[model samples]
Target: MDTMRDRFAPVVSRILDEDPRVAVVLAEIGLVPFLEAQRRHPDRVINVGIREQLLVGAGAGLALAGMRPVLHTFASFLVERPFEQVKLDFGHQGLGGVLVSAGASYDVSGGGFTHMAPGDVALLDTLDGWSVQVPGHPDEAEVLLRQAIGAGDERVYVRLSVQANREALPVDGQHLLTVREGRRGVVVAVGPLLDQVLAATEGLDVSVLYATTVRPFDAAGLRRAVGASAADVVLVEPYLAGTSTGAANDALADVPHRVLGLGVGRRELRRYGSVDEHVAAHGLDAASLRERISGFLDVGVPGVPA
Candidate 1:
């Protein structure tokens, strides 16, 4: 299966060919894949060397000039390194652009902490009027990319990752899709973590909701999922833990609800390891998640007591 980054290149290339207003700005991180697109649309596809700030500034400038800019780079460089430019050039200036980031969380675990961006989503949450999409599969990535490009002057962020599920879920860029139903609680799985979340909650009496677009928080869908009963929500994101717990609380502010936000922890792991190792260390793998989820929900495991 093609990784999300692999699918991104061809989709953006086709968009550049078909849409004249679309422009892609790179910072020499993922340049190889966009080489052909650059050759065809020299002015539209730009490379700003390793200058991460300039990459965002240039993209914001293009947006200011009535062009739709798609900024590409690793998550750390795209959002963390050039965050000031992102805030002022785009948010403060009220410009609209698409910020597409590769290397989600520990996708590039071998590259060490410099390449990991476990707080990318949480950092972006500080800004207003930005739509964030975390696609679990390449096909879903293509859909969300098209929607972001055609958003017409709306600020958008598309997070691409090497991790993916076995199949694509029908994500419409808005609202959550119900994958399983139960009366006890609801488990909200974000992006690539859906498969692991499903396996963790196997046979557990809880509903599972799949989320691709998380910026808006899908408050209404979450409320509907919990229904009129006192709610218990476990948000399984691929980013910083408790990143969206506040949002979840706000969504159910009027009702009685308890939320458990699980994801990449804040502690820095100095040793570089494989992605699976990173997942295990963060307690995001199936086995760890099963224990955590059951403990939080007060639901007994098949062979264990609550």
Candidate 2:
């Protein structure tokens, strides 16, 4: 019911008002809102300039000194650049801090390839005690952000999409928003694309499941839900499907899991282009996703060996 800015503004305002030890760190473009919030309450914010490495490193240092730090940065800069600091300083030392990575995936359309961090989801998993989340919408982002701040963990990355397009889904971690009662197969959507999958279920008896949490999935709950469905399970993610947690759903459940890997194909980091074109080229667009679903449905499951 609340707007994205509305959801974030109040919490940030409250934190600034009460938590004197709470400091906000912004990296480059992520500084847009941090600066605005700082203007509103100039005394409380801490701008880390464009040094993303130092930005994370500083957050680690601040947390080590018993201060609460909320660090904001683009997904690529926040995850890829200061990875050593994040792993060694935070994960190893067990520092307490929140790293809010904004504009994940195609959200960085205008920012080009250099600004977009495709490897973050895969990279974050390498750390031992990190909590990684990718919220489909702004409202979900708000809830996850609140959770991350209060988690009191060494590291947490709330991967956020740029556009606030879809309305917030009832995040009960149930059915991922029921699409349609179908006999064919269940389409599991990872993020914002749940809307498109729902739309594609017009004539088909399709069910859509939104797997919101990447790392800590509710396996027992998911198994119960998918077990109730007659169709096979198809897991879809915004990025490459198999390499990330999207693929792990197969191992987590007994259902016949079909992982749909989306996003750009891995290659030499030679090409240069904005994020939108890159995603589109990789078949991450709405039409491409729909086509993939249709193909999956048409192909059906191959006869399994007895």
Candidate 3:
């Protein structure tokens, strides 16, 4: 019953009431809930108008002043527009906060390029120890968020997208959770793409590993997931294509492996269409992913049956 938007307000409110060191910075995104938060805790909740740079700047200042800031905005504005601030303010200053972003990758397809930011996670990855989380379900989002907040001053990026999974899979730790087993290869599902990836590989011989946390890439867990199989790994992410390629390569350095990366398409589509159309174009939908991944497992996976 808890949508990501609905769950966020209560979490922010609870943090404001329970932790005096917490502050929520807004850039005119969630107006109503944020306004109520402002009313409840006037000083702690800050609305910095439409200035994304200032939004992050204020958060950095807040952190410098001994406050754990939570900055909310679209992915583009929060990360792309104010990237310098994110790098200099948080990374250089050695300050940390929570960055809860909506509209992951092409989720805002109708809004076009200005609103779409598939490269946000990659940009943050270049900075420092940013804990990136892509929760598949709203229930998962809530659980992951509370865990992120529990780590004070840990830079956490929670990417929230429109699509969600059928249900919340059991997730107790940051390590990968295997939902289904197979004999050929392993499919690592990141964030909201779990359901779609599951659908894509339903009839295939591939182990599915669900991960809510992307940053601090669980290499050991990934190795465990690969096990003694062919080590054929397909990382299905919801962000930019090949965003986690480096991490994946680093994770399986010791093992001789064949990996496939899938996510948002790199090509620019000028036309404004439905989200489903965009999703299909990016090769993120079940059918497209099934085709590509099937090909990978069929030809690329060694000693594995198609």
Candidate 4:
């Protein structure tokens, strides 16, 4: 199966080769994919040793120097560790570029909590006007990447995770896609969780909206889906447990609505295991998702109708 990471190298290479104005900033991790690009374009493909802060700083510098820089590394190192640089260098300085992050949440399960970054998307939320994309498949990732690159002078964050759907899918636009329609409620499936969401909602009477570009939140589309219903939204993100909860609330704030935020749970699972094991532990498997969705829809949780 071709994971999102597998699709990254070629996209970056294409951008680097085709767009002379583009550059690739890398830390020590995840550099194997872009080795050929580095060999070819030594000036553009820069690996600043093991310095995460420098990675962002160099990218910011590159951006300031009239080059669109694409920073790459594991999610934890790329975002969490060098956040200060990302904030001041990119946000404060008003510089725009692309940040390609790998190993979302517990992707490197055996690498332990130090390597986990479930809160990456949530962190990006703190910034102002960042284009965030969580692609569910390799095809979607490539399309979104091309779009993001095409989106010049805008700060974009392309989240690359291990989890992916069966086939590569395309987005109609930059907004939420209505995969399936229903009247009861709406299930917002963010990125790779589409297949799982589909499997979970097989016989249910709920609308399913897939989101690749989640930063803008696509509130108008969400309202349309809710129609005359209670505006019950279930956000199934591949990142932190309730990363997109605020987005959901903001989207449905105008109407009477309730939300059940689900993803990798908040509680830290200290045990070490495989990625699949970690996923199940967080109640992200198909069975757990189905049960939760059914429960949220069937029962009257804390508020709303029974």
Instruction: Output the number of the lDDT-best candidate.
Output: 1
Model 2 lDDT per residue over 1-306, tens place: 444434554566567677667777776654555556688667457776789888888888878778778887777788888899888878888787888776576465565667767678778877776666666777777777776776655467777765443677656422244545666666666765566556544455556667667665555545555564333556666655554445445445455555545544665234555655665676656666667776766632335211
Best by TM-score: 1
Better of 1 and 3 by TM-score: 1
User: Measured by TM-score, how close is model 4 to the native structure?
Assistant: 0.95
What's the lDDT for residue 150 in model 1?
Answer: 93
Q: Which ten residues in a row have the lowest lDDT in candidate 1?
A: 297-306
User: What lDDT score goes with residue 213 in model 1?
Assistant: 97
| lDDT per residue (tens digit) for residues 53-171 in model 3 | 99999999999999989999989999999999999999999998999998887777788899989889888888877888888888887888777777778889988877888898766
Instruction: Report the CA-based lDDT of candidate 2 relative to the real structure.
Output: 0.64
Can you write out model 1's per-residue Cα lDDT over 48-139, one digit (the tens) per residue? 99999999999999998999999999999999999999999999999999999999999999998999999999999999999999999999
What's each prediction's TM-score?
0.98, 0.80, 0.94, 0.95
Residue pairs of candidate 2 with colliding backbone atoms:
176-210, 182-205, 241-261
Alpha-carbon RMSD, candidate 3? 2.6
Give lDDT: candidate 2, residue 227: 66
Using TM-score as the measure, name the better of candidate 2 and candidate 4: 4
- List CA RMSD, all candidates: 1.0, 4.9, 2.6, 3.2
- In candidate 4, what residue range of length 10 has the lowest lDDT sum? 297-306
RMSD to native, candidate 2 = 4.9
Q: What lDDT score is found at residue 298 in candidate 3?
A: 74
